[model samples]
Target: MAEVQQNTGGDGKKGQQKKMQIRVDFTPMVDMNMLLITFFMLCTTMIKSQTLTIALPSNEKVDNVENMSQASEDDAVTIILDAKRKAGSMEVDTVNGKVVPVVYYYFGKPGGPEGLGDAPETIAARNNLQESEFLGNDEKSGKARGIREIIQQRNKDVLTEINKLKEKYASGGFGSLETKEGREKAQLAYDEAASKVRKDENLKKPVIIIKSTPQASFGSLVSVLDEMQINSISKYQIDNMTKADSVMVIDYQNRHHK
Candidate 1:
């Protein structure tokens, strides 16, 4: 009985020892979980996407134009006002060395020298004479008449063309002031001129550059802007010196020629 008691105690002690042994093997499992997380992170390149590149201008010290006298003509639209008529003309000269004319057409007059009459009846008379005399039996005459018809179809066409240019420039795109119809009409007008049609390659719209003398009233400048705004050119750069860099710059030295 004593021997049996000793064997039973020995078995109990062995069981107790077995129970005390720590058998937790979490190291391999932890390693596997870490590997899985790292693998997924490396494979997930979708988190990185392409981004747009834009050049940002620096706010460094640059050559500054103190006033209208220091402003450059290259940065302005030069306007020469002919005192003979109360009306003024505009020209667009860009910083990139491009110059274009901002041509204006009278509301009722056909856009040409011959159409420069005091009244609509005079314009009609001029058209009649051109149709009967210079353009007699010629295909050119027929084309000219067609162009006139297009201009006369609606005054809004000209305004629409001007609006298109304004929108283009406002959206950072270059816009031509001349429309296909306007150019065609201008061509017909030139043909009717007494002298050879001196084609103005420089004439365009939207970014009209002009120069007005100091004697010119502020109302004249406002008038030009009004015309542009009416045609939907809401944004414009005036050719003058201002406190803001975004505003137009004027050059007194360049104004000597006009």
Candidate 2:
């Protein structure tokens, strides 16, 4: 509420009209503005940070064979993550204000059948390590690019159904995408669809085993995990780098660095 006051000044000149000035009280307005600010500050929602929830295995070894998840060599894809190294040195390399992540992957075991076998002669032939990098979706096609593309290619059998689900989601098959409540419903529906595809035994999906070097950035690790999620891979897990995994990464970097 506001109040107005009228003031009259008089020189009292003959036949001259008197002037009136109106003043508006601003104290109420100032108080109202403060209250509005406080109310908005209290009512506004803050964004929450997202996280990946991983289930860790127990320390004790499982005695039951049925409890362990086993994979055949044909269905296994091993992804090794490392920080790009300087030529002729083990030093980490950076590019464009970011730590460069080097990715090497292989189907089946490290060093192939011989398993990083006895010596250098066999190691060279069987190393089986191929390099790649984490890349975002293509600007034009909107399809995933880089390492993501490679993984998706291997898991296309599952992606065929997942892509359909994506199309359904975009078309509002789950719910209206325009509103907040609708988006939530759509996401739940999408998750359910993808989950069904992942668990479908009839569909063939690659089991990705992710191993990272100590020198790699946490961001790179997260980026790789994002690929797994984006690809709808249900069988991937974070695993420790074995001696062979470490050796293969070193050999790949050394040979390629030159």
Candidate 3:
């Protein structure tokens, strides 16, 4: 009887052991999951969205005549920023004029020879010049001068002067134009362009119209504006064709489940 009882006890112990076999040790798995979560949390970046601040024209009511003639050829300057190129390029266009190539110089890189210089001074000096100088002035000197001819002349003169300065710098002359001076000159050239547009006889009080793609960043726009030396008298407007009544509707019931 004692032997039989012992056998029964041993059978019970085997059954308990078999039941315990299915149990898993999940502590290591839990620890690994925690570690992965922490790592991902630390590695992930918290992206922040930024909104561009632009002053829009007031929606005040005006006389029909005033509204009809709000923008005169002389009153507004148009700047077109196109990022559609394989490498983005900015072009400036006038009310009734063809697109003119405008170069943008970054502080650190070797930009095109067209646009480069420092701040307000160079730009201010440029503004004093007549539009004919940029767009092309008809030479009264009985010489044939088209817009392209004038542009070429200006480019040649500018490049010649710049090359001389660069050569001087290479020769280790202390009086040579430094990088800062070059940047300043470039900015002055851009401002001069803006001034020409504003003072153009073809337009009245020139309004600066900027046409930029959605892909264009605010920094690019700001840089151009800064170079132009635009002030309180100038007005900036955006071209958005979307209607105010447009609304987006989504239907969730029709969505497919994979």
Candidate 4:
């Protein structure tokens, strides 16, 4: 708001000029600005930051060797990450200046039923390493491909239970999903139930052991771990590649590439 003040001429002089002053009130404008800021703060929605959560290995020591938990041979699955190699050499192969990743996996053991013996002939004959790709879902069918398909098949039991839980949650078995508060509560309950199913002793879940070659990119390792999470796997660990693992890989490349 603005107001004008006029002063009368001095001593009633005919030629004297009148003086004027203007005043503005900004308090109302300040109050309106404060209200606008408050309205935006209350009505605006904030975006949540997306992140990948991974469980790290514990540093606690065990007193007894027998007390250590081990995966059963029937349920063990080993995945090896490696870079693509040239036709007959150890040189890494690249496509469009990007290192191509290779995935290998085996069930039960590295050298199949007989195990990896020191003899070269035995390794050549019994090596169970099978190559695969990091293919995603097929566009037309929406079905998983390559390594993702393998993990999903091995983790069928846990995934089946998780799917059942999803159905139950959608049907309001855990809680109502109508309101924001109700949705949050329902999600918490669903997560707890899924965790229990993953850890259940009766369920037949595969224990995955991830290994990587020295030339393998860190990105490849992360990709394999992503598969574990996407497939709802609970029993998995990152481990060092053994001598036998190296032998099998070299022997495989030699036989196949040549």
Candidate 5:
């Protein structure tokens, strides 16, 4: 509510004009603001923070030989992350103020059936470590390149089944994707089918092992894990780098970079 008061000076001259004053009462407005704040606080829904779930390695050390034997060497894929080295130096290299990431991968046991031996000559000779980049995909063809291509190739079987399930869902095989309720039900069914495909014992799937050098950036590690999810890889774990892995990487760098 607002009030106006007109004041006329008692002994003023005849030509003197009256003055008016205005005063506004804001108590109601303050109360209304408090009510609005309370209403919003009670009715508004808070967004839950999202996080990615990743499987971390066990604290207890396990023998690599026994681990490899459990899952066939053919199905094992080891991806190593390293910081790019400067020319003719062991220092980390950066591009445009960012550390350049280098990817190295080896299939099966390190150094094949014989394993990585103590001798430097033997390590150099048996080094199966291959270098790759984090190049995501080709823009025109939408084809995966670099490390992504290797992972997709190994997980093609599961992906094939998943793709089929997608086709069925899109064609209303699961249910009608038209209505809201229908879309929800169809999505649930699609998820269940995809889960079955991933867990099917008959499907041939690769077990990926991720390792990183001391100098590798956290962003690079996250990128590799993103690839695992993008490729629909179910069996993947973060593992510590071994001495043999160090030797092989060193030998490979020495041979090629020199």
Candidate 6:
């Protein structure tokens, strides 16, 4: 509510002035401001979440050999993601302030010639589980470290060409980098060049098969996928883990926890 008080200024033969004092109650205004602030807080978009798109093969059993594309042992890399678990239990293990992700990788196949073997003893012998972490780019060289470095090494042929394309994009070779539209055009050109690099027949590339345990965090899955994009990997798929995968993980943890 607002009110105005009138006061007489001065009196003269033929001139007089009147003054007005306005009193405004700010209680309602404060309430209105709070409501507006909350409204915007609820409506505004904060951090945009990133997602991965994966295509799964049909559930139907395929009996034809000619239709299947088989990857040779030399070209396959199997990556397994698991959460840090208790010593010998299935409990979620965390260290510091974050959920630690344990990575296991093998050059080819789940198990060697004797494929997971028959018992836990043989499984441990055949288990190729190795531990790694999700680390960021190096401070000085800006080169990716940790598992990223390992992946980049395997996909060096593809990434070598992609890096050239990235350089070209940054230098404004595709279009002017000053404007948004030009940036978009440049990005499209870079993507096409990167795709061509991935499809190059002369270069050798590894086909990655990513498997995750149920206890693995979604953030870790995204981190691994980010490595694929950063390295310009062409062929990769998210697959369900098998019994051998579980046995290997548990056995490795049990042996190491001691």
Highest lDDT, which number?
A: 5
Report lDDT per candidate: 0.34, 0.82, 0.38, 0.86, 0.88, 0.79
lDDT by residue (1-258, candidate 6, tens digit) is 999987754453345556679999999999999999999999999989876786666655572231133432657787889888876677888888577887888766666645778776788788877777788799999988888888888998888878788888888988889989999988988878878889988999998888898888888999899888878888887776767777887787788964
What does the lDDT read for residue 62 in candidate 5? 69
lDDT of 2 by residue, 1-258 (tens): 444444344556666655555567788899999999999999988878898877644555562222223532677898888898877888888888689998889988778766788687777768899999888898898988779989999999999998898899999998899989989989998988889999999999898988889998989889998898888888876777777877887777767887
- Candidate 5 stretches with Cα past 4 Å from truth are 1-50, 62-72
lDDT (10s digit) by residue, model 5, range 1-258: 999988867887787887889999999999999999999999988988666777565566465555656444677999999998999999998999899999999988889779888887888888899999999999999999999999989999999998899999999999998999999999999999989998898999999989899999998998998998788888887777877788888898999986
Candidate 2 local accuracy as lDDT?
A: 0.82
Top TM-score model:
6
Cα lDDT tens digits for candidate 4, 69-121: 35327678889999999887899999998889999888887798778898988
lDDT at 242 for candidate 6?
Answer: 68
Give the worst 10-residue stretch by lDDT in candidate 4.
63-72
Q: Which residue pairs show backbone clashes in model 6? A: none
RMSD of each: 22.6, 5.6, 20.9, 6.8, 6.5, 3.8
The residue-by-residue lDDT of candidate 1 on 189-240, one tens digit each, is: 4334312211222323222333444444444454444444333332233443
Q: How should the candidates be ordered by TM-score, best one leading? A: 6, 5, 2, 4, 3, 1
lDDT (Cα, 0-100) at 64 in candidate 3: 29
Which residue pairs clash within candidate 1? 77-209, 77-210, 78-210, 78-211, 79-210, 79-211, 101-202, 177-205
- The total number of steric clashes, by the backbone 3 Å criterion, in model 6 comes to 0
TM-score, cand. 2 vs. native: 0.76
Superior by TM-score: candidate 5 or candidate 6 = 6
**Error of model 6, residue 8, in angstroms:** 3.5
Distance from true location, Cα of 43 in model 3, Å: 7.6
Clash number by candidate, in order: 8, 0, 23, 0, 0, 0
TM-score of 3: 0.25
- Lowest lDDT 10-residue stretch of candidate 3: 244-253
**Residue 193 error, candidate 2, Å:** 2.8
Higher-TM-score candidate of 2 and 3:
2
Candidate 4: C-alpha lDDT: 0.86
